[model samples]
Target: MGRILLTGASGFVGGAIHEYLSNSSTHKLTVALRRPMSSLPVTTTLAQIDQIDGVTDWSRALLDSDVVIHAAARVHVMQESSTDPLTSFRKVNVEGTLNLARQAAEKGVRRFIFISSIKVNGEETSLGVPYTACAEPAPADPYGISKMEAEKGLMRIASESGMEVVIIRPPLVYGPGVKANFFNMMKWLYRGVPLPFGAICNSRSLVALDNLVDFVVTCIDHPKAANQVFLVSDGDDLSTTELLKKMGRALGKPARLLPVPSGVLTLAATLLGKKTLSQRLCGSLQVDITKNRELLNWLPPVTVETELDAVAKDFLDKHV
Candidate 1:
């Protein structure tokens, strides 16, 4: 078993990874936290750091690590009032990631696995043409640009230092403890709130929390994952209306959906300054994971239906 160092142990995705690694006997895990945390899932050595910024020192944390899985990043904010949003994102996502990679390489670490977003491709996709691993990057937003730059820097570092770097770009991940848009959708479905997604025939690719964590753990030791960029999903694509209907079934409620024109929805959101959210609902964003499956022989272990039921059950268990 190899010694692994994981960042972002307290966050949603990281917490899932930590729990899975803790339950397994394949690797010894250590987690770096911004503050002291109690009742961690794994029996791991803790390294305390103030923040993951440009100047954060990660030398001590890299002392005896074999692999580094970076799961922490400054996610995109809807209304970022910062004067320089790109610079702020770079400080934590790009600079901080490079700092950790450099330290790990110096300490003889074998691999670095970076958790990236599918936004690196673009916010939306054209109908029927899903993003592939070989697609040229077209990062539109500042957050995507920062992740793209970080990926480039990691590649350069790997070429120079001979440390294997694996980059996995995942679409929206949802499960029992999910938050943000996915969580909001679950809540609305449970409450039987009417939605205007009946006419939104846009396909979206999403990954389950367990599937993402499973792929990440596999990358830690997989020979074919070395120095590669992969796009991961649940291996099933669904339209917006279909997703909501499935969610309603899981919650034991009828999908109270109204058939609304996509144009009208976009115009209304534009007037309300929520154009991005509307686009996300109306536009297609699918990813093709053929390369990962063919190369690594990996498939998502959990189906979307099973995960949605799990999420619905958890929501009811908490609220009822």
Candidate 2:
């Protein structure tokens, strides 16, 4: 078994990846964290890195590590006080990521798997047209731009060195311990709260946490995944109305949706300075996973329905 170095092991998505890696005996896992946690598996090594930024040293952690799975980054913040959001994002996401990758290459790490976001292609997709790996990048926000830049930098490092680089761009990821909008949606669905999204006909592609980890584990050794960018989803696209209805069913509650006009909802959101939130609910953001399926023959191990049930169960447990 080879050694795998995982960064951002204590974060939301990273925490899930850490759990998955720690349980597996296939690879000896070394987790890089800002601070130690109490419940990490006994087999895993905890390497504390004070902060991940432009100058954070990673030489010690990369030594003897066969693969580097980089799941750490400065994700989108709701209320960022930084004067320059792009600069702040670049500091951690771009600069810190490249520094680690370069050091890993120097230290003879065979493969580097980077978990990126679909925002690199833009926030919304046109109806029936899903984002693909070959799409011309049109990053809409500072966070997306930073990820795009990091992708380019990693590819350059891969070219100069022999280290194989794999990039996976995932859409909204949801599962147990999901927070933010998905968590709120589950709570509202569980309580049977009436939502005004019945008329919004937008298709979104989301990935279950398990499915993402499965793919990342596969890429750790898959030869075909090297030097390629992949856009991943659950292979199940659903409209906003369909999502809420399924969520309600998972929660054992009525969908309870009011058929409000999409225009009215958008206008109200605009008046309340929540245009982006409304657009997220009313917009289409689908990704084509044809490459992942055809090349790697990778199918999502967990179904969306199964993951939705897990989310509902977790929410109920917390509320109770």
Candidate 3:
């Protein structure tokens, strides 16, 4: 294996990938990021990739790589209307992606690994039905739409460029240094806060950071993964109540789950416009990593129990 070029080296997901490759391998790692790589080790080269011009100025990073993992993406969050999210996503996900893919073909890179999201399949995975690699895409939000568009674009590039492409779609990743909802949960659990969540028995797909990175590295050279889309998970689905309980267990506290009816909670959340939490609590989005496990012959290295404990210990140690 030759040098590998990774974009979005500073993002949460990308940084995890960068950390994994940086500390665990002898293979050359090249990163294209906005800020300097001084924050990173000296061995990691700081390659500048101008966002607006990377399409035309990719020779710097895509020149000598065995593969290029496009982890950098424009994540569309709430209240991003003025941002013209579709165009913003296209600038990076589609145009930037093709630009690098074409350059890789010209530069003779062997493979292209893309970290996609499960949202491409849809915002809502049917109850009791697991989303699979063969499921058709039905993105509901701008972010999901952009990821879907980029996936199609990448497929076209892979078709025309004669380079192997491995696409991975992971759902709800959590681990050490975890932020967003996961961090919020840790905060709440640390304070021994009660949750109105026992009555909810919905399940959603989630992957631990280590498992995600492990799969990405596995697909890097696994021939079976070439030009294929794989849905990945921790190989086990956990309910919202179960997740909170696990967090409590990890924090050495007992979960305070109220036995309120699921419908009442959904109604109250809807009225309060807290639908995001509503859906996650009462929704279903399980992924059958059967394809990933059987095809790539890979299973997640970290179990949910271990991952949850590690997350709590790391956060508690840092914040305490």
Give the count of colliding residue pairs in each prediction. 0, 0, 0
Candidate 2 is scored at a TM of 0.98
What does the lDDT read for residue 53 in candidate 3?
28
Q: For this target, which candidate reaches the highest TM-score against the unseen true structure?
A: 2
Deviating ranges (above 4 Å) for candidate 1: none
Score each candidate by Cα lDDT.
0.90, 0.92, 0.83
TM-score of each model, paired residue for residue: 0.97, 0.98, 0.95
Q: lDDT per residue, candidate 2, 10-55, as tens digits?
A: 8888888898888898999999987888877777888889988878
* Better model by TM-score: candidate 2 vs candidate 3: 2
Single out the weakest 10-residue window by summed lDDT for candidate 3.
Answer: 49-58
Candidate 1 — what's its lDDT?
0.90
Model 2, position 160, has a per-residue lDDT of 99
Query: Where's the lowest-lDDT run of ten residues in candidate 1?
Result: 36-45
Best to worst by lDDT, what's the order?
2, 1, 3
Best by lDDT: 2
- Tell me the tens digit of each residue's lDDT in model 1 across 18-103: 88888878788888998877776455778888899877888877768999999989888778988999999999999999998988
Give one digit per residue, the lDDT tens place, for model 3 in 1-320.
Answer: 47889888888788898998887556678999877865776556678876832445778787678989889887656457555777777777777777777788788988999888888898667768999999888877777877787788778888988888888898999988988778887798788788788877788889998899889889877888899999988988988888999999998988888888889999999999888778877888998888877787888999999999889899989987
Clashing residue pairs in candidate 3 are none
